[model samples]
Target chain A: MSTIEIAGKTLELDADGNLANLSDWNEDVARELAKGEGIEELTDRHWQVINYMRKVYQENGDAPSIRKLTKESGVDTKELYSLFPKGPAKKSAKIAGLPKPKGCI
Target chain B: MAEPIEKVSIVISHGSLEGVYPGLIMANGARMEGIEATVFFTFFGLDAIIDKRMDNLGVATVGNPAMRMPGGIKMPTWLGAIPGMSRFATYMMKKEMEKLDIPPVREFIEMIHDAGGEIYACKATVDMFHLSENDFCSSLDEIITVGEFYEKSAGAKIIFT
Candidate 1:
């Protein structure tokens, strides 16, 4: 594990860069993380995906895969790639402060 | 720093819902990891790309020794051979996948394509099945020979499902 200082708080992150402690997540932390991923601004659309992921994780105990994200997160697949380029599911989960979604190779 | 995996190629050889999903899921997962991913649909796997059949792919319950119920109980092969069992199993699996928000096969393929993953149909399989390029989903990248596929897949991790 490694630590990243976000919003004056040092938080542990797994090797995959996912938050080690889900409780350490906040909007500020998400913004910090998103900045590192090349997203300078967090639009409402971005929040929609992050909030949906966090809600589903809290209920299902794991982050949803890209399939679920695109289908149920009010974000289409094309918009997801544009919102979280390269790897939407993984990147969004990191910004949402959730674990790396299971079933992703 | 070590280089992350660059590419991955998956081969889908079976037609059942159970058979097709592993390849799709793995390819999607690879793309989620920023790895270039490709899926080669061959033989029965062609069912997944066939324009008319892709959306209606069914589970193969008969002769499948690994069939299981929702509670994880093993289903006997003999019982699986009963009429409508395959359709019933497909329905159950589809329901479970829907609950988890997994897209159906056709949409899944489109998602992969839109995500920049490549979809291929085996040329031999297409010829054998009397299917032309028009018979496949529009997302199909190409129908190439096994030799050509191997050439393109060289240096990439290969997975057979």
Candidate 2:
């Protein structure tokens, strides 16, 4: 079991990726998570991925892959590249406040 | 690994539609990194956030050499406003979005708001343009002055693109 605190609520991530504290998650948590990722300012496009990721994680209890993110979020791969400039997985996941993704290092 | 710098706030000011997207794109990028992002629309830039003309924006071809056809056929600035040209350019942009599979501007703005980010309109520009609050896009949180905007964006990065 693993523990994470988002927006002042404690959450648990089991081996299967289930959230024990789903009610604690909210847009404010996403904002705080974004803040921790170094996003002090925000834009409409940024929210697109953050919101989608939160929804996907809450539903599937598993993080989205880059391909799944693009498909589900409806943001173009090129535009995603342009938005992240660094690369989608690392940067986007960081801002979305998800845990460090696998295979990112 | 190197440690990361703290979040930086970026301010984007633009009037033209073509010019505005860069600001939007950059601001979105910054937000993804948890950086502070603010966009200030003045004069023509205000037109972009305003409801009346956001969907129907013009392009800049006068000085852009890269904006050419397959064989480097440069487009003229005068042609940008030639009746159907604005619509054509808008359509071309939409087509590009379709090709990239990016969402529309409306959806993008909604995403920002849902994430608890802020969107503000320029008070002075709004007054100068004779646009009431009702004329602005529904996503706007408030109408603020340059000074107010500066205060909010201070202590963060600033970008004018």
Which candidate comes out best when scored by lDDT?
1
lDDT of each candidate versus the true structure: 0.89, 0.62
Tens digits of per-residue lDDT, candidate 2, B19-109, equal: 7777666655555544555666666777676787776666654566566542557777665546776556667777875555344565555
Model 1 per-residue lDDT tens digits across residues A1-105:
689987778899898888899888889999999998889999999999999999999998988778778778988988888888879888888899988887642
**Ten residues in a row with the worst lDDT in model 2 chain B?**
B5-14
Clashing pairs for model 1 are: none
State which docking tier applies to candidate 1: medium
- Per-residue lDDT tens digits for candidate 1, residues B40-156, read 999999999889999888988777677897788999988888899888989998998887777889988999998988899999989988889888889999999999899989889
Model 2 achieves a DockQ score of: 0.07
Winning model by TM-score: 1
Per-residue lDDT, model 2, residue B100, is 51
Give all TM-scores, in the order shown: 0.84, 0.58
- Report the lDDT of model 2 for residue A87: 50
What is the CAPRI rating of model 2's predicted complex? incorrect
In model 1, what is the error at residue A15, expressed in angstroms? 5.1
